[model samples]
Target: MARRALLSEAWWQQATIIPDNEREIAKHYTLDRSDLELIMRQNKAANRLGLACVLATLRYPGRPLADGEVLPAGVLRFLARQIGAPWESLQYYPLRDFWRDGKQMISA
Candidate 1:
């Protein structure tokens, strides 16, 4: 899915609520300090959500979720409700950028 299609006016509205401090959450999750800082820099909701998706996928010990792949309907609905985004829009929101950027910082 294209990045442009992923973002909508509703997506911005849903992301209005700034997430809790990433630093604290990172500590709780045992994420590396450097990686936590990188995540902190992504102030937008889409980017943050992408980061969350990456982290959530990492918790499972298997092939990670890939960009452009449709998430399970239930999981997508749950995330949409939690973040106040339109559920259908999530299908286009790929995690590639978030994962790549996150990996670069964490690996550096």
Candidate 2:
């Protein structure tokens, strides 16, 4: 049987992005110096970005990233700049979704 969604798409959309406020972005997405050091240890620009984004999602949303998740622009900018990466480098970070056994897979 196909799995069902636990929440409405509309609600998830709302939940995914911070409201583009500076204070809110800072509050939710700010990485500590320790986390920044850890993220920077990632080999590639994309890897650094991916790790930081995953941490941000877990910090604010209390969950790991979902497939095709769109983070807030301000939050993305915050994280990329904090990591010393070009904001557009995000294009190099691949989506985590994968196909397996005739189904789209999400990690538990």
Candidate 3:
């Protein structure tokens, strides 16, 4: 299994301001864009990957689904649509849970 890594202190620097730096990030992960960017500025490319890692970890479920089949919802689907991919589909699948978690479903 691919282990989820934590975001390094540097990711705060490189993170683009999305919604607000406070409500969107700090309230949850206790770290914000500034914090992440600072870490990135102090580190290198490999360290930047921590941005995605930390975000994913911070966004990790409050609890694993009892059925283990909880899929992305409508909002996420719409976002995915914007990111159109040949394999994209309306079906739901956690990034890590296609075959192991449930049936594979795709959307476009």
Candidate 4:
């Protein structure tokens, strides 16, 4: 028989378990000046917020964000407030190449 996976599917989907509490959210998801500069370089509001989420995922959960992954609401609110975008305006974020591209660029 094949060996069972050690980590849960949720671990593959980083940012899946980010805490929703205000202090924990701020601790893990706050965008710093460099992060803000990078996020601001993205073309549009949605892209900025999307990139921020990806960056946070890479930093905390230390893995690539899975497609269609839903981030914790507190994390979203923290990033959105920093990027000055509405938290509900991530219309262009879902499963988009923008996220993968940003992930690649950031990793590079």
Best by lDDT: 2
Q: Against the true structure, what is every candidate's RMSD?
A: 16.3, 8.7, 15.0, 7.5
Q: How would you encode candidate 1's per-residue C-alpha lDDT over 4-105 as one tens digit per residue?
A: 566788975454322244453333334355645655575455654555456544652223555455445555444445444566644434543444534642
TM-score of each: 0.36, 0.68, 0.22, 0.69
Tens digit per residue, CA lDDT, model 4, 1-108: 899999888865553466778888888888779989898988778889889988998888776656667888878888899999998778776545535645742321
Query: Across residues 1-108, which tens digit of lDDT does each residue of candidate 3 receive?
Result: 997657755674344223223344334344355655553562333233333333433354332223434233432332333223212432322333334334555432
Task: Supply every candidate's count of residue pairs whose N, Cα or C atoms clash at under 3 angstroms.
Answer: 0, 0, 17, 0
Worst lDDT 10-window in candidate 2: 95-104
Segments in model 3 whose C-alpha atoms lie over 4 Å from true places: 1-32, 62-108
Candidate 4's error at 39, in angstroms? 0.7
Collision pairs in model 2: none
RMSD of 3: 15.0
Query: Between prediction 1 and prediction 3, which has the larger lDDT?
Result: 1
**lDDT (Cα, 0-100) at 12 in candidate 4:** 55
Query: Model 1 compared with the native: what TM-score?
Result: 0.36
